[model samples]
Target: MKSILFSTTLIAFLALIPAGEAAAQLIPQPWVSVGSRNDETTFSIGARALNLGVEFGLGTEDSTGVDALAFVNLPLIDQVSPYVGLGLYSEDQGVAVSGGVQINPTDNLILGAGYHSIRGVNGQVGFRF
Candidate 1:
């Protein structure tokens, strides 16, 4: 199941990229996202500097966690960029392996899905400035 989702995401990303162009910088922007994980609603606030970012999340479990992530973005024809990231979270959440992908349909809108080793899967939506 995970393989299928990964493969499909890869295919979609490849299909969107142009023949020749540099991948855009995806992590340097200040962004915020809201989503749900394992039936628990989550909210994240973060700022990305260069290829790395730091984020804080509030979960319905009544715990607040912090994560540091590294991102790689592939530009898929203009502003349609797809990015993948891996991160580590700390605090009451301890250390949970986390990773995700986000696709930018427009310059300001982002849609994504992610998985957390302890928190389960999530669906995300956000805006980038």
Candidate 2:
């Protein structure tokens, strides 16, 4: 059956990932952002592992939906970086694209501003805890 085949593929894919190595990434980056989606307010929480990040977004009550995003973080300089990503959203919002810059003035601090096709502009602050 189609479902069985998909399940097998999913399991196989997960099996190939180096779970232990990924969990052992040098820096544990946890961040949060507040933005807008189609003029409605949205908030997101995400984490970074080396050059990758994933975010989960929650929309306004009127909008009533969630978004999941995956990003590739590229370092541009010693204390700054730019990122690009794509994601899916609920409530028939469809796919969204995003790009942003992050500023790390100190090892324990992160500040960011970004634009999301579906989530609008957002500002973020993160730090080691």
Candidate 3:
């Protein structure tokens, strides 16, 4: 199941590079996106990776966590860009590094998959601007 998700994400990511490149030519700066962060079902406030950008969650939550991520945008096709990020998350369990890919299947939708340090796999979908 995890492999399937990762494979699908990779395919979608590659499919968008061409579109992204075309769009980049029209737009000077790269696109920016903001959305809710979640592990799977429960929504939480925190960052997944450092360079990926910042995310804040609304609600009551108490926990200290930090993650460092690096992302690169790839122009797959016109008006579409796919990006992949890698980073590490540290918490009570110590530290774990994770790698994931995000594909913008549409203008506002992002699909992604990541593996946590504790050997857990995560798949998520979020809206992006």
Candidate 4:
């Protein structure tokens, strides 16, 4: 069945992660974000492993969602760093295309604004190590 094939593929991919050349560059950090979408406020708590991050959201109207994002981190002349990402989302409201920009004013804090194709606009503030 398709499900079996998908599960097998996923397991194989996970098994190979530890052998990746960039494994040493993976930094895991706890992350939190608050945003607005579909005229409702949404909050997410998750972890970032290198350029990839996954989060679960608690939104208004009791809607909940999950997101998997991959981002590019760009460092500027000042201490600021900006990142852009594209990803997939699964939400109680509906599925969506998710992408966002996060800016780090300092090494620990982040200010972000973003959008989801189906969920609408978003903003966030979080701290990470």
Q: Identify the leading candidate in terms of TM-score.
A: 2
Any idea how many clashes model 1 has?
Answer: 0
> What TM-score would you give candidate 3 relative to the actual structure?
0.44
lDDT of 3 by residue, 5-123 (tens): 99999678657557754444333222222222344232222232212443222211222334445555543543332333333333444444545566667765656665444334555
For each candidate, what is the lDDT? 0.62, 0.72, 0.43, 0.63
Best by lDDT: 2
Ordered by TM-score, highest first, the candidates read: 2, 4, 1, 3
Candidate 4, RMSD to the unseen true structure: 6.4
Please give the lDDT score at residue 16 for candidate 2.
57
Candidate 1's C-alpha runs over 4 A off are 1-28, 75-92
Tens digit of lDDT per residue, candidate 1, span 46-103?
6664456676776546666767777675544444333444444444565656677766
lDDT for model 1 comes to 0.62
List model 4 lDDT by residue over 54-124, tens digit each: 76777556766777777664534433334444434444556646776776677677677777654457777
Candidate 2 per-residue C-alpha lDDT over 4-70 given as tens digits, one digit per residue, 9 for 90 to 100: 9999996785565578644544356888999976667878887776556787776544333334434
Model 3 residue 63 CA deviation in Å: 8.0
Looking at model 3, report the run of 10 residues with the lowest lDDT sum. Answer: 55-64
